[model samples]
Target: MKQLTIVGAGWAGLAAAVAATQAGWHVQLFEASNIAGGRARSLQQSFAGKPLDNGQHVLIGAYSNTLALMRTVGLKPDELLKRIPLDLRFADGQGLSLPNWPLPLNMLAGLSRAQGWNLKDKASLMQAAWGWHRARFECDLTWTVEQLCNASRLSPRVMTQLIEPLCLSALNTPLNHASAKVFLRVLHDALLGGLGSSDLLVPRVDLGELLPNVCVEWLRTRGADIHLGTRVSATQVSALQHAASADSAVLLACPPWEAARLAADIAPKWALSCAELTHKAIATVYLHCKDVGFNGLARPMMALHSHAQAPAQFVFDKGALSEQHGLLAAVVSACTTERDDVTELVHEQACKQLGLVNVEVVQTVVEKRATLACIPMLDRPEPFVAQGLWACGDFICGPYPSTLEGAVRSGQQVVTQISQVTHR
Candidate 1:
């Protein structure tokens, strides 16, 4: 049997292991952290007797690759994720929320019925949507999202309520720096890709139970070796060439920095690209109400009117989604504030927006490097770093930005490339 050594047991590493093992390869998976899930993992610390995620993340129905991966590991998406039609309604019900209708109709109906939008605003959005659809959702590689919005003549109302939040949540980068081409790809897939493609898939459970924990068990039962808290050093990876046979390949699914360091001596050019990748931070502030259950949000999740002082873009009701009563999570994408400031600002914002009372900060998690900046025309590192040595992660060159789906697709793509090389 062919041997595959996978370093880093995050979603990317785990996905690769599953794919490789299913294809009749012996897999050895190693993780430096005690647990998997990487940036999206559940925290060890508890808040109100329930663990909070490192950051609150949601999936879209368009993420077919991620959904398929979950099912491959004996998990059901319908059970784990709460599916609802594309809803971006604010607490005051003054935003876009698509009905359960099909494509084109849903978009038309949603736009027509959009609250706080004048006829001119609705017409402007529809015209822009038509233009994008006509052009097949392609845009110039050098153009930023801000440039696209300006060129499309999107209203300030639409930009704030729709485009800004969507861009930040998807790319985790500011509008002026985020790639327009990548953002369009996301829109095209979501808006035009069949029924329910635009639906939001919010997690009913924590990040760990959503996929990683179950993935480890699935791989182990299939006889793949799993190693937790095992950090593979640069020297150790370099020695693999002499220690292992030519048929044995190494897959680095670690973070960009670690991958760059491990392959620096062998693949300088690839390492440089990986090392040069810039990232943005995401902060999730968990809050709990002492008086009563914090179920005051109009929906399970509601968009916030964000500004300089108000850092959070969206807030989630943990009580509604996960049954963690009185708990709430406010997410600040592309966050740049200090921890204390985030807590203070988010608490204030949530109380004012959702009209909650006596809410205290439970925990504040700020992933300093949550995701790649995803700026326009980013030159991400390829999967094939060297002969018999590869890399896979959200940072890998791909159509999508740094996301769970991107990470899974990159990992699976590596295995396909490996198979083709060996066969050739």
Candidate 2:
């Protein structure tokens, strides 16, 4: 039997393990941390009298690969997630909410009925949408999202209320630096790719329960060697390579920086490129407002107007999604400031924007390197790091920022590559 040494038990690694095991390979999964979810995992600490996510992550219907991976692990997407229509409902009552209808019509209705937008703004937005649809939402690879928006002549209100939030959330980089092609690909897949593709998927359970924990059980049941809290070193890599038969392989499904370090001797140029790739930060500040009488946002998630003092782009009521009542998670994408400052700023922003006072800052998680700084024309290494040693992660997933879906897709792809190798 062919054996596969899969390093890093993150979602990507877990996905790869599951797929490989199902394909008749003996898998040995290794993780540096005991936790499985990597960036998407939940912590053990009790925040605001309840368990909170490490960060607030929102999935869209366009995350087909992630959803499929979940299903493959025996969890249904619709059952586990609080699915809702595509919308940017704001705290101050100025946003766009798409109807639960089909593509172009839903988008048209959303654009036309967007609150606080002038007639000219609506017309300009409609025209831009029409053009993008006709053009299949493709854009020049070298252009920034800001450049594309300007070229499309999008309304300032639309840009601020709708486009900016979407760009920041999806790309984890500001529109000025984010790739227009990547942004358009995401937008096209969500808005134009048939019914429910634009729907928001808020996790009803913890991030770990969504896939990682379930994946561990699945891997264990299949008799795959699971090594948690174990770090593989240079010696082990060489040993594994020497110990394995000619048909065996290694899959390094780690983060880009870690991958760069591990593959330094194996693939120096690829490692350098991976190491040089810049990253963006994401901060999720959880607040407990148990006394707030207001019924959360207009929807489950709300976009908040933010300035330098108020860094939160969006706020979610955890109570609305899960059993965590009065718990709100404010997300600041591409965050660069300190966690304490972000927490305070988000608290202030929430009080001012939502009129919710006495909000207790439960926990503030600042992922300094949350995602790759998805700039225009970013170059990434391919999945094949070497002959038998392959690599897969969010960074290797082309055309996507560091996202759960991207990670899952790359994981699945890595298994496919391995299957081909085994067959050959």
- Candidate number achieving the greatest lDDT relative to the actual structure: 1
Cα lDDT tens digits for candidate 1, 284-335: 9999877565445668888999998999999988888888888889999999
Over 4 Å off, model 2: 48-50, 242-245, 292-298
Q: Which stretches of candidate 1 lie over 4 Å from their true place?
A: 242-246, 292-296
- Candidate 2's TM-score reads 0.97
- Candidates' RMSD to native: 1.2, 1.4
Per-residue lDDT over 271-348 for candidate 2, one digit per residue giving the tens place of the 0 to 100 score: 898899899999999888856475655567888897789899988888788877778889999998887788888898
TM-score of each: 0.98, 0.97
